[model samples]
Target chain A: MTNVLNKAINEKPVTTGMLLALMAATAYGSSQFLAKQIVTEIAPPSVVATVGLFSGFVVLMGLSIGNLPKDRKAPKKAVVFLILSGIASSAGVTFLYTALELAPVVIVAPVSSVTPLISLSLAHIFLPKMESITAKTWVGAILVVAGVSLITIGSHI
Target chain B: MTQAIIFALLAALGWGTSAIFVRLGLQNLTATPGTAISLAVGTILIGIVAVTAHGPTAFNLNPNEFAWIVLLGVLNYVLGRYLNFNSVNLAGISRSAPLLASAPLVAVAMGILIGGETINSFILLGTLSIFGGVILVATGGGRG
Candidate 1:
């Protein structure tokens, strides 16, 4: 059992990564539906965001406590970036919950999923070495924007 | 409707930029600590907002609501985020990103099945186009 576990962990990173990504997407995607239900029943979007994030923080803190001593000495820059990232993500969650309150899950999910296009643009500008924007990427981005436009327009009609 | 779409786009922008920051920070920290710190920070920020907007009562959810919130936190923040960070570490953001973007597909299906969300051909077409575009961007074949 240990050898099997080790082999799975060590053998194929790309495959494992893809699988993990898929699983994450599924969990996150389904979350919108659940979130919609929660918001309808209880608190507002801000409260939901706060409670959910705090619960998550508690869980992650518990899980990470063992590594905290060694990891606490991270560079100041990384800490700053992570804090900023957290702020940004908090805003995202707030907006997402607001959107969910206003619209159906199907409509809100696809529209918000366009994060990749924005991420790609940011990567091109900030971290060129990390990701280079190609013609295909441009086309893809255009298609995504166009699709989002269509959905928005169509939903109104 | 327009308001909802705008808010959703804002969310996209926030999440998109957050990914870059996470990647940058991950350079110095591993997934576990990085996730813990970021989530803790985000929670505090959101908690502040919640307090200011709705007062301390904002945290006063019903027992069922609290349970649901806990479940959501576990599912999305703990499991979902852990997988996402690990995927980025392993596959690089460029490759793992589009796959992550595919979350909408799952959401749409689940929404219809569980949430009773109705879908039209327009929505179908839009989803297909978005998925196609995300794939193109992910496999852009650019210099790494």
Candidate 2:
């Protein structure tokens, strides 16, 4: 069992990665809906974000404790990046909950989905080796932006 | 409406850029540690905001609501984020991002079924457009 798990972790295939991404998306998307429900009862978006994140942090810390020593320490550069990323993530989630409080899940979820467009653009500019903005990427981004615009506009009227 | 849109856009920017950092960080740290550190930091930052905005009472909640929040934390932060880190580690941002973008589609469906959300033609159309765009981006103009 350990060997199989190790193989799965060490030799992740593209299909597995794609599957994981899909699952993550589904879980995240559902959480938005759930969060909308939670916020209706829980006041202050910050509170919701705090509780949810704190809970996850505790669980993840518990899970990582056993592996802490064996794992190679992250480089200083990576630690910096991770800290920045965590700040960004906190900002993103706080904003997301605030938006959910204001708008319906249908509207908020699609708009937030534009993360990839931004992600792709940022990757293209900063991490050129990580991602190249091809024509298809541009076209898709346009579509996503257009779609988000429609939803945003429609929500108002 | 305007406020919501602005905040949502801000979220898009934050989340989008964070993916890059995750990828970069994963290069040096394993997924579990990377997820733990990032989430821990995020939780602290957001917790501070919550406390500052609403006082310590901001953390207060009824039993039922607290239970739900815990469940959401597990589903989203633990399971979802762990998988997300793995995906980025395995597939890179360009390839995995579009797949993750499909979240809104799932949310729309789940919202309707569970949250009693009413969808209109525009919402449906917009959702489809976004999904199509994500697919196009993922497949690289239908190449594969």
Candidate 3:
């Protein structure tokens, strides 16, 4: 993984931050399917959500403890964003699992797959530096929408 | 269809916003703390949901169900996610995204083998098409 990131960073043309963002996107996409498997066993959506968030918290905390600076204090703004992100993520995972519970795996999969599309679009509107719509993006968006539709249709049977 | 679609869209918005926030929060802290902090907040939120959704029943889970939840909490939430984030950190989004996208295909296989779900012709077509679409996206044109 670091090799890929290094390539993205050292390559004259590609920026490291952009490369990082892309990595985040890929993680987002892959998480959906793996999550689907777990969610199947832990129904009620909320249980899955709780377990996921709690476990992620525990693991991240355990690994990071020794590295903390003794005098460090979190800035108020970052704290706000952290809490907001947490709220948004909790809501997102809950809704995602709700969709999964109601619909077939195939159906839920594509619906949430629209995430990149929405995120990119919203990023264009808000974080203009992060991304902009282009012809290729349009094509990709169309394909994703079509793919999602096909999945939904296929799942009905 | 309407309800599911709406729920999914809501999920997308929440996740998208969270992604942005995760990036922002990471600016100041190390990845581990940032992930843990956000997850802790989320866990509290989920606890609220469990309480409201099941009330007293939430406390009465059977031993089997509780065990599965704990195992899943560790494996799926902690281990699976850590690997995922690490994969992104290592591979870059482009290479990583495609690998991650393979999850759906993996899910299809799991469903058949583990869930005892049968696939028809439609599933084959849909899965293939989804993969094709994802490939196009991962290559992400220089545009949005």
Which candidate number would show the highest lDDT if scored against the true structure? 1
Model 1 CA lDDT for position B15: 89
Model 2 clashes, total count: 0
In angstroms, the error of model 2 at B50 is 0.9
Instruction: Report the alpha-carbon TM-score of model 1 versus the true structure.
Output: 0.90
Best by TM-score: 1
- lDDT by residue for model 2 (B77-131), tens: 8889778978888877767877887888888888888888888877788888888
Q: What DockQ does predicted model 2 obtain?
A: 0.59
Q: Residues A97-134, candidate 2: write the lDDT tens digits.
A: 99999888888888777776787778777887767677
TM-score of chain B of 2: 0.80
lDDT of 1: 0.86
> At residue B45, what lDDT does model 2 achieve?
92
- Candidate 2 docks at the CAPRI level of medium
Instruction: Please provide, for model 3 over B1-144, each residue's C-alpha lDDT reduced to its tens digit, 9 standing for 90 to 100.
Output: 557767877987897888778767767766667667778888888888788887746545677666665655565456556656665665566766666656566555655665566666765766676666665565573443
lDDT of 1 by residue, A1-157 (tens): 8687457658987877878889899999878888888877788998898888888889988888898877888998999999999999889999999999999888888888888788879888899888887889889989998889888877876
Total backbone collisions, model 1: 0
Model 3: per-residue Cα lDDT over A8-124, one tens digit each: 656732345444434444444445544665566645788767866676677667788887662147676776778888899789889988886776555565556556666676667
**Number of backbone collisions per candidate:** 0, 0, 5
